[model samples]
Target: MKTHRLVQNFSGYRALICALPERSTEALAPTLKKLGLQSELIGHSPAAPVVLPFENINADRDILFIDGDMTLPMDWRCLRGAGRSALPPAPVVGLVGIEAPSRLKALLLLGATAFLAKPVYGGAVYSALFLGVNEYNRKEILVDAVDVLYEKRRRRAVVIKAVVSLMNIRNIDEDVAYDLLRKESMRARLSIEDYCEYMLGLRQEQDKNENAHGERQALKG
Candidate 1:
Protein backbone atom coordinates (compact mmCIF):
# COMPACT_ATOMS: atom_id res chain seq x y z
CA MET A 1 0.00 0.00 0.00
CA LYS A 2 2.99 2.28 0.45
CA THR A 3 3.84 1.91 -3.24
CA HIS A 4 3.37 4.99 -5.40
CA ARG A 5 0.73 4.41 -8.07
CA LEU A 6 2.91 6.27 -10.60
CA VAL A 7 6.01 4.64 -12.09
CA GLN A 8 9.10 6.05 -10.40
CA ASN A 9 11.02 8.84 -12.13
CA PHE A 10 14.71 7.88 -12.45
CA SER A 11 16.34 11.29 -12.03
CA GLY A 12 19.57 11.11 -9.98
CA TYR A 13 19.46 7.31 -9.52
CA ARG A 14 22.78 5.45 -9.59
CA ALA A 15 23.42 2.93 -12.36
CA LEU A 16 25.84 0.21 -11.22
CA ILE A 17 27.40 -1.48 -14.22
CA CYS A 18 28.88 -4.90 -13.42
CA ALA A 19 31.13 -5.94 -16.30
CA LEU A 20 34.79 -6.74 -17.00
CA PRO A 21 35.44 -4.39 -19.92
CA GLU A 22 34.96 -0.63 -19.58
CA ARG A 23 33.91 -0.69 -23.24
CA SER A 24 30.94 -2.86 -22.30
CA THR A 25 29.25 0.05 -20.56
CA GLU A 26 30.44 2.73 -23.02
CA ALA A 27 27.23 2.80 -25.01
CA LEU A 28 25.09 2.97 -21.89
CA ALA A 29 26.62 6.10 -20.32
CA PRO A 30 25.35 8.94 -22.50
CA THR A 31 21.83 7.52 -22.68
CA LEU A 32 21.61 7.21 -18.88
CA LYS A 33 23.10 10.71 -18.42
CA LYS A 34 20.35 12.09 -20.62
CA LEU A 35 17.78 10.56 -18.23
CA GLY A 36 19.57 12.16 -15.22
CA LEU A 37 21.11 8.87 -13.99
CA GLN A 38 24.70 8.83 -12.75
CA SER A 39 26.60 5.86 -14.24
CA GLU A 40 29.36 4.11 -12.28
CA LEU A 41 31.23 1.35 -14.11
CA ILE A 42 32.72 -1.62 -12.25
CA GLY A 43 35.29 -3.49 -14.38
CA HIS A 44 36.97 -5.50 -11.62
CA SER A 45 36.78 -9.27 -11.62
CA PRO A 46 36.05 -9.62 -7.87
CA ALA A 47 33.88 -6.48 -7.97
CA ALA A 48 35.06 -5.46 -4.45
CA PRO A 49 37.55 -2.87 -5.65
CA VAL A 50 35.29 -0.61 -7.72
CA VAL A 51 32.03 -0.29 -5.84
CA LEU A 52 29.95 -1.33 -2.83
CA PRO A 53 28.97 -4.94 -2.32
CA PHE A 54 25.81 -6.27 -3.93
CA GLU A 55 24.36 -7.01 -0.49
CA ASN A 56 24.24 -3.30 0.20
CA ILE A 57 22.20 -2.68 -2.97
CA ASN A 58 19.31 -0.27 -2.29
CA ALA A 59 16.17 -0.72 -4.38
CA ASP A 60 15.15 2.89 -4.11
CA ARG A 61 18.29 4.43 -5.60
CA ASP A 62 20.34 1.65 -7.22
CA ILE A 63 19.85 -0.02 -10.58
CA LEU A 64 22.16 -2.88 -11.63
CA PHE A 65 23.53 -3.75 -15.07
CA ILE A 66 24.74 -7.36 -14.91
CA ASP A 67 26.76 -8.66 -17.87
CA GLY A 68 26.14 -12.34 -18.59
CA ASP A 69 29.51 -12.62 -20.36
CA MET A 70 31.58 -11.31 -17.45
CA THR A 71 33.12 -13.40 -14.69
CA LEU A 72 31.06 -12.73 -11.58
CA PRO A 73 32.75 -12.29 -8.20
CA MET A 74 29.73 -14.03 -6.75
CA ASP A 75 26.62 -15.63 -8.13
CA TRP A 76 24.52 -12.74 -9.46
CA ARG A 77 21.44 -14.78 -8.56
CA CYS A 78 22.47 -14.51 -4.91
CA LEU A 79 21.72 -10.79 -5.23
CA ARG A 80 18.08 -11.65 -5.73
CA GLY A 81 16.35 -11.99 -2.38
CA ALA A 82 14.93 -15.43 -1.60
CA GLY A 83 13.79 -17.61 1.34
CA ARG A 84 13.05 -15.02 4.07
CA SER A 85 13.23 -12.17 1.53
CA ALA A 86 10.65 -12.38 -1.23
CA LEU A 87 11.78 -9.51 -3.48
CA PRO A 88 15.15 -8.49 -4.94
CA PRO A 89 16.97 -5.57 -3.30
CA ALA A 90 17.22 -3.60 -6.55
CA PRO A 91 16.16 -3.61 -10.19
CA VAL A 92 18.55 -5.52 -12.51
CA VAL A 93 19.02 -5.15 -16.26
CA GLY A 94 21.08 -7.93 -17.88
CA LEU A 95 23.53 -7.18 -20.70
CA VAL A 96 23.51 -10.44 -22.58
CA GLY A 97 26.31 -11.21 -25.10
CA ILE A 98 25.85 -14.96 -25.29
CA GLU A 99 22.57 -16.37 -26.53
CA ALA A 100 23.06 -19.77 -24.84
CA PRO A 101 20.29 -21.16 -22.69
CA SER A 102 22.69 -21.67 -19.77
CA ARG A 103 23.77 -18.03 -19.82
CA LEU A 104 20.18 -16.85 -20.06
CA LYS A 105 19.25 -19.11 -17.16
CA ALA A 106 21.90 -17.45 -15.02
CA LEU A 107 20.40 -14.07 -15.83
CA LEU A 108 16.93 -15.34 -14.89
CA LEU A 109 18.31 -16.69 -11.61
CA LEU A 110 19.86 -13.29 -11.01
CA GLY A 111 16.27 -11.93 -11.12
CA ALA A 112 16.92 -9.62 -14.06
CA THR A 113 13.87 -7.43 -14.49
CA ALA A 114 14.72 -6.73 -18.12
CA PHE A 115 17.29 -7.59 -20.83
CA LEU A 116 19.33 -5.77 -23.48
CA ALA A 117 21.41 -7.30 -26.27
CA LYS A 118 25.25 -7.35 -26.39
CA PRO A 119 25.49 -3.95 -28.10
CA VAL A 120 23.55 -1.66 -25.79
CA TYR A 121 21.37 0.74 -27.74
CA GLY A 122 20.86 4.32 -26.58
CA GLY A 123 17.27 4.20 -27.79
CA ALA A 124 16.33 1.08 -25.77
CA VAL A 125 17.87 2.21 -22.50
CA TYR A 126 14.87 4.14 -21.25
CA SER A 127 12.43 1.29 -21.86
CA ALA A 128 14.69 -1.26 -20.16
CA LEU A 129 15.22 0.97 -17.13
CA PHE A 130 11.54 1.70 -16.87
CA LEU A 131 10.51 -1.97 -16.94
CA GLY A 132 13.31 -3.12 -14.65
CA VAL A 133 12.75 -0.51 -11.93
CA ASN A 134 8.95 -0.78 -11.95
CA GLU A 135 9.14 -4.57 -11.92
CA TYR A 136 11.33 -4.47 -8.82
CA ASN A 137 8.86 -2.12 -7.15
CA ARG A 138 5.98 -4.42 -7.98
CA LYS A 139 7.72 -7.42 -6.43
CA GLU A 140 8.58 -5.35 -3.37
CA ILE A 141 4.89 -4.61 -2.86
CA LEU A 142 4.11 -8.32 -3.04
CA VAL A 143 6.86 -9.10 -0.54
CA ASP A 144 5.44 -6.59 1.95
CA ALA A 145 1.95 -8.00 1.47
CA VAL A 146 3.25 -11.51 2.18
CA ASP A 147 4.97 -10.32 5.35
CA VAL A 148 1.76 -8.73 6.66
CA LEU A 149 -0.25 -11.88 5.90
CA TYR A 150 2.36 -14.03 7.69
CA GLU A 151 2.19 -11.91 10.85
CA LYS A 152 -1.60 -12.03 10.87
CA ARG A 153 -1.57 -15.83 10.45
CA ARG A 154 0.89 -16.28 13.31
CA ARG A 155 -1.24 -14.12 15.64
CA ARG A 156 -4.44 -16.00 14.80
CA ALA A 157 -3.77 -18.63 17.47
CA VAL A 158 -3.24 -15.95 20.13
CA VAL A 159 -6.53 -14.32 19.17
CA ILE A 160 -8.32 -17.66 19.50
CA LYS A 161 -6.70 -18.35 22.87
CA ALA A 162 -7.70 -14.92 24.21
CA VAL A 163 -11.25 -15.33 22.92
CA VAL A 164 -11.57 -18.74 24.60
CA SER A 165 -10.22 -17.36 27.88
CA LEU A 166 -12.77 -14.56 27.77
CA MET A 167 -15.56 -17.07 27.14
CA ASN A 168 -14.52 -19.15 30.16
CA ILE A 169 -14.02 -16.21 32.56
CA ARG A 170 -17.10 -14.15 31.58
CA ASN A 171 -19.47 -17.21 31.23
CA ILE A 172 -20.33 -16.14 27.70
CA ASP A 173 -20.52 -17.76 24.27
CA GLU A 174 -17.50 -17.63 21.85
CA ASP A 175 -19.35 -15.22 19.52
CA VAL A 176 -20.10 -12.74 22.31
CA ALA A 177 -16.55 -12.99 23.67
CA TYR A 178 -15.12 -12.27 20.20
CA ASP A 179 -17.48 -9.32 19.75
CA LEU A 180 -16.37 -7.82 23.07
CA LEU A 181 -12.72 -8.23 22.22
CA ARG A 182 -13.22 -6.72 18.73
CA LYS A 183 -15.06 -3.70 20.14
CA GLU A 184 -12.51 -3.14 22.89
CA SER A 185 -9.67 -3.44 20.34
CA MET A 186 -11.30 -0.74 18.16
CA ARG A 187 -11.75 1.50 21.20
CA ALA A 188 -8.14 0.95 22.27
CA ARG A 189 -6.95 1.89 18.76
CA LEU A 190 -5.01 -1.35 18.40
CA SER A 191 -5.11 -4.20 15.95
CA ILE A 192 -7.16 -7.24 17.00
CA GLU A 193 -3.95 -9.25 17.39
CA ASP A 194 -2.41 -6.58 19.60
CA TYR A 195 -5.51 -6.38 21.77
CA CYS A 196 -5.60 -10.17 22.10
CA GLU A 197 -1.94 -10.22 23.17
CA TYR A 198 -2.59 -7.47 25.74
CA MET A 199 -5.58 -9.41 27.17
CA LEU A 200 -3.56 -12.65 27.35
CA GLY A 201 -0.66 -10.95 29.11
CA LEU A 202 -2.96 -9.20 31.60
CA ARG A 203 -4.70 -12.51 32.34
CA GLN A 204 -1.37 -14.24 32.95
CA GLU A 205 -0.26 -11.59 35.45
CA GLN A 206 -3.62 -11.79 37.30
CA ASP A 207 -3.41 -15.60 37.47
CA LYS A 208 0.08 -15.41 39.01
CA ASN A 209 -1.12 -12.94 41.64
CA GLU A 210 -4.15 -15.12 42.49
CA ASN A 211 -1.89 -18.19 42.85
CA ALA A 212 0.44 -16.29 45.19
CA HIS A 213 -2.55 -15.09 47.29
CA GLY A 214 -3.91 -18.67 47.63
CA GLU A 215 -0.48 -19.99 48.61
CA ARG A 216 -0.20 -17.35 51.38
CA GLN A 217 -3.72 -18.17 52.64
CA ALA A 218 -2.84 -21.92 52.85
CA LEU A 219 0.39 -21.14 54.75
CA LYS A 220 -1.53 -19.01 57.26
CA GLY A 221 -4.09 -21.84 57.85
Candidate 2:
Protein backbone atom coordinates (compact mmCIF):
# COMPACT_ATOMS: atom_id res chain seq x y z
CA MET A 1 0.00 0.00 0.00
CA LYS A 2 1.75 3.15 -1.16
CA THR A 3 1.35 6.07 1.26
CA HIS A 4 0.49 8.39 -1.59
CA ARG A 5 -2.31 6.14 -2.76
CA LEU A 6 -3.94 6.27 0.64
CA VAL A 7 -3.52 10.02 0.85
CA GLN A 8 -4.89 10.58 -2.65
CA ASN A 9 -7.92 8.43 -2.09
CA PHE A 10 -8.74 10.10 1.22
CA SER A 11 -8.43 13.81 0.23
CA GLY A 12 -6.88 17.06 1.64
CA TYR A 13 -3.26 18.09 2.22
CA ARG A 14 -1.37 14.93 3.11
CA ALA A 15 1.67 16.43 4.77
CA LEU A 16 2.43 19.39 7.04
CA ILE A 17 6.17 20.16 7.05
CA CYS A 18 7.40 22.36 9.86
CA ALA A 19 10.96 23.00 10.94
CA LEU A 20 12.90 24.48 13.84
CA PRO A 21 14.89 27.70 13.64
CA GLU A 22 17.85 25.87 12.17
CA ARG A 23 16.31 23.25 9.85
CA SER A 24 16.00 24.31 6.21
CA THR A 25 13.12 23.29 3.94
CA GLU A 26 15.23 24.40 0.97
CA ALA A 27 17.19 21.16 1.39
CA LEU A 28 14.14 18.96 0.71
CA ALA A 29 11.98 21.05 -1.62
CA PRO A 30 13.45 19.42 -4.70
CA THR A 31 12.91 15.93 -3.38
CA LEU A 32 9.35 16.72 -2.32
CA LYS A 33 8.51 18.22 -5.70
CA LYS A 34 10.04 15.26 -7.47
CA LEU A 35 7.85 12.93 -5.46
CA GLY A 36 4.76 14.97 -6.43
CA LEU A 37 3.87 15.33 -2.77
CA GLN A 38 0.78 17.33 -1.86
CA SER A 39 2.24 19.04 1.15
CA GLU A 40 2.10 22.38 2.96
CA LEU A 41 5.00 24.27 4.54
CA ILE A 42 4.50 25.86 7.93
CA GLY A 43 7.21 28.40 8.64
CA HIS A 44 6.27 30.70 11.53
CA SER A 45 3.30 30.24 13.81
CA PRO A 46 0.02 31.17 12.07
CA ALA A 47 1.60 30.65 8.68
CA ALA A 48 -0.72 27.68 8.82
CA PRO A 49 -4.03 27.44 10.64
CA VAL A 50 -3.57 26.07 14.17
CA VAL A 51 -7.02 24.56 14.38
CA LEU A 52 -7.88 21.49 12.30
CA PRO A 53 -9.07 22.51 8.83
CA PHE A 54 -11.47 19.59 8.53
CA GLU A 55 -14.09 21.37 6.44
CA ASN A 56 -11.54 22.88 4.09
CA ILE A 57 -9.45 19.77 3.46
CA ASN A 58 -10.35 16.23 2.54
CA ALA A 59 -12.03 14.49 5.44
CA ASP A 60 -10.20 11.16 5.06
CA ARG A 61 -6.65 12.27 4.34
CA ASP A 62 -4.22 11.41 7.12
CA ILE A 63 -2.13 14.31 8.40
CA LEU A 64 1.66 14.08 8.43
CA PHE A 65 2.93 16.64 10.91
CA ILE A 66 6.51 17.75 11.40
CA ASP A 67 6.66 19.91 14.52
CA GLY A 68 10.00 20.71 16.18
CA ASP A 69 8.99 22.05 19.56
CA MET A 70 7.55 18.82 21.00
CA THR A 71 10.19 16.42 22.29
CA LEU A 72 9.96 12.85 20.97
CA PRO A 73 11.96 9.69 20.26
CA MET A 74 13.45 8.68 16.94
CA ASP A 75 11.53 5.41 16.69
CA TRP A 76 8.27 7.13 17.62
CA ARG A 77 8.80 9.57 14.80
CA CYS A 78 9.91 6.72 12.55
CA LEU A 79 6.65 4.91 13.22
CA ARG A 80 4.80 8.04 12.26
CA GLY A 81 6.91 8.40 9.14
CA ALA A 82 6.33 4.82 8.14
CA GLY A 83 2.62 5.24 8.61
CA ARG A 84 2.43 8.48 6.65
CA SER A 85 4.58 7.16 3.86
CA ALA A 86 2.56 4.02 3.27
CA LEU A 87 -1.10 4.46 4.13
CA PRO A 88 -3.83 6.75 5.51
CA PRO A 89 -3.77 8.22 9.06
CA ALA A 90 -0.69 10.33 8.36
CA PRO A 91 2.24 10.32 10.80
CA VAL A 92 3.25 13.35 12.87
CA VAL A 93 6.91 13.99 13.74
CA GLY A 94 8.07 15.90 16.81
CA LEU A 95 11.63 16.86 17.76
CA VAL A 96 13.20 16.08 21.12
CA GLY A 97 16.34 17.35 22.92
CA ILE A 98 16.62 14.88 25.81
CA GLU A 99 19.28 12.20 25.33
CA ALA A 100 18.55 9.94 28.30
CA PRO A 101 17.86 6.34 27.26
CA SER A 102 14.84 6.10 29.59
CA ARG A 103 13.34 9.28 28.23
CA LEU A 104 14.00 8.21 24.66
CA LYS A 105 12.44 4.83 25.35
CA ALA A 106 9.41 6.51 26.90
CA LEU A 107 8.94 8.65 23.80
CA LEU A 108 9.27 5.65 21.50
CA LEU A 109 6.80 3.71 23.59
CA LEU A 110 4.56 6.76 23.50
CA GLY A 111 4.63 6.45 19.65
CA ALA A 112 7.27 8.72 18.12
CA THR A 113 8.13 7.32 14.69
CA ALA A 114 11.42 9.11 14.11
CA PHE A 115 13.48 12.02 15.47
CA LEU A 116 16.29 14.33 14.55
CA ALA A 117 18.82 16.50 16.39
CA LYS A 118 18.46 20.30 16.50
CA PRO A 119 19.54 20.92 12.93
CA VAL A 120 17.04 18.98 10.83
CA TYR A 121 18.15 17.73 7.42
CA GLY A 122 16.31 17.37 4.13
CA GLY A 123 17.67 13.83 3.85
CA ALA A 124 16.05 12.90 7.16
CA VAL A 125 12.72 14.29 6.08
CA TYR A 126 12.95 12.56 2.72
CA SER A 127 13.90 9.29 4.39
CA ALA A 128 10.87 9.47 6.65
CA LEU A 129 8.64 9.81 3.60
CA PHE A 130 10.36 7.50 1.12
CA LEU A 131 11.02 4.67 3.54
CA GLY A 132 7.22 4.31 3.54
CA VAL A 133 5.02 2.03 5.64
CA ASN A 134 1.33 1.16 5.52
CA GLU A 135 -0.77 3.54 7.61
CA TYR A 136 -4.06 1.71 7.08
CA ASN A 137 -2.84 -1.10 9.27
CA ARG A 138 -2.19 1.41 12.04
CA LYS A 139 -5.73 1.68 13.34
CA GLU A 140 -6.20 -2.08 13.44
CA ILE A 141 -2.87 -2.62 15.13
CA LEU A 142 -3.42 0.20 17.59
CA VAL A 143 -6.90 -1.01 18.42
CA ASP A 144 -5.66 -4.51 19.20
CA ALA A 145 -2.79 -3.13 21.27
CA VAL A 146 -5.21 -0.96 23.23
CA ASP A 147 -7.58 -3.87 23.70
CA VAL A 148 -4.84 -6.04 25.19
CA LEU A 149 -3.87 -3.24 27.57
CA TYR A 150 -7.50 -2.63 28.51
CA GLU A 151 -8.18 -6.32 29.08
CA LYS A 152 -5.19 -6.64 31.42
CA ARG A 153 -6.51 -3.75 33.51
CA ARG A 154 -10.03 -5.17 33.44
CA ARG A 155 -8.78 -8.57 34.59
CA ARG A 156 -7.13 -7.02 37.64
CA ALA A 157 -10.37 -5.25 38.56
CA VAL A 158 -12.35 -8.44 38.03
CA VAL A 159 -10.09 -10.30 40.46
CA ILE A 160 -10.61 -7.63 43.09
CA LYS A 161 -14.36 -7.62 42.58
CA ALA A 162 -14.62 -11.40 42.67
CA VAL A 163 -12.79 -11.48 45.95
CA VAL A 164 -15.05 -8.85 47.41
CA SER A 165 -18.14 -10.58 46.11
CA LEU A 166 -17.09 -13.87 47.71
CA MET A 167 -16.42 -12.19 51.02
CA ASN A 168 -19.88 -10.65 50.92
CA ILE A 169 -21.60 -13.89 49.94
CA ARG A 170 -19.86 -16.21 52.41
CA ASN A 171 -19.43 -13.77 55.30
CA ILE A 172 -15.75 -14.82 55.21
CA ASP A 173 -12.46 -12.93 55.36
CA GLU A 174 -10.91 -11.33 52.30
CA ASP A 175 -8.28 -14.09 52.12
CA VAL A 176 -11.02 -16.71 52.07
CA ALA A 177 -12.75 -14.91 49.23
CA TYR A 178 -9.48 -14.81 47.30
CA ASP A 179 -9.05 -18.53 47.82
CA LEU A 180 -12.55 -19.19 46.54
CA LEU A 181 -11.93 -17.06 43.47
CA ARG A 182 -8.69 -18.91 42.77
CA LYS A 183 -10.40 -22.27 43.01
CA GLU A 184 -13.27 -21.25 40.81
CA SER A 185 -10.92 -19.83 38.20
CA MET A 186 -9.02 -23.10 38.10
CA ARG A 187 -12.19 -25.12 37.78
CA ALA A 188 -13.82 -23.10 35.01
CA ARG A 189 -10.67 -22.55 32.95
CA LEU A 190 -12.28 -19.29 31.89
CA SER A 191 -11.35 -15.65 32.19
CA ILE A 192 -12.52 -13.29 34.92
CA GLU A 193 -15.81 -12.35 33.26
CA ASP A 194 -16.63 -15.96 32.64
CA TYR A 195 -15.65 -16.86 36.17
CA CYS A 196 -17.74 -14.09 37.67
CA GLU A 197 -20.69 -14.79 35.43
CA TYR A 198 -20.54 -18.48 36.26
CA MET A 199 -20.52 -17.74 39.93
CA LEU A 200 -23.53 -15.49 39.60
CA GLY A 201 -25.20 -17.89 37.11
CA LEU A 202 -25.45 -15.02 34.64
CA ARG A 203 -24.24 -16.79 31.48
CA GLN A 204 -25.86 -20.17 31.80
CA GLU A 205 -27.36 -20.05 28.31
CA GLN A 206 -24.06 -19.09 26.78
CA ASP A 207 -22.35 -21.97 28.58
CA LYS A 208 -24.73 -24.61 27.28
CA ASN A 209 -22.61 -25.32 24.20
CA GLU A 210 -19.51 -25.69 26.36
CA ASN A 211 -21.35 -27.98 28.79
CA ALA A 212 -22.57 -30.10 25.89
CA HIS A 213 -19.00 -30.69 24.78
CA GLY A 214 -18.23 -32.32 28.12
CA GLU A 215 -21.36 -34.42 27.89
CA ARG A 216 -20.30 -35.68 24.45
CA GLN A 217 -16.89 -36.64 25.77
CA ALA A 218 -18.48 -38.48 28.65
CA LEU A 219 -20.68 -40.48 26.27
CA LYS A 220 -17.67 -41.33 24.07
CA GLY A 221 -15.80 -42.59 27.11
Question: Number of the top candidate by TM-score?
Answer: 1
- Looking at candidate 2, what is the lDDT of residue 84? 28
**Model 1 lDDT at residue 65:** 88
How well is each residue in 128-175 modelled by candidate 2, as lDDT tens digits? 543222333354456556667777787676667767767876799988
Tens digit of per-residue lDDT, candidate 1, span 9-119 = 789899988876656457897889999999887766564544446676677899988888876555444565567565556788989888899988888777788998878
* Native-referenced Cα lDDT, model 1: 0.82
What TM-score number comes out for model 1?
0.89
Which residues of candidate 2, in runs, are more than 4 Å off?
Answer: 1-13, 19-23, 43-49, 52-63, 67-90, 94-111, 116-124, 130-147, 159-221
Candidate of highest lDDT: 1
For residue 184, what is the lDDT in candidate 2? 75
Which pairs of residues clash in candidate 1, taking residues 3 or more apart in a chain or in different chains?
none
- Global lDDT of each candidate: 0.82, 0.51
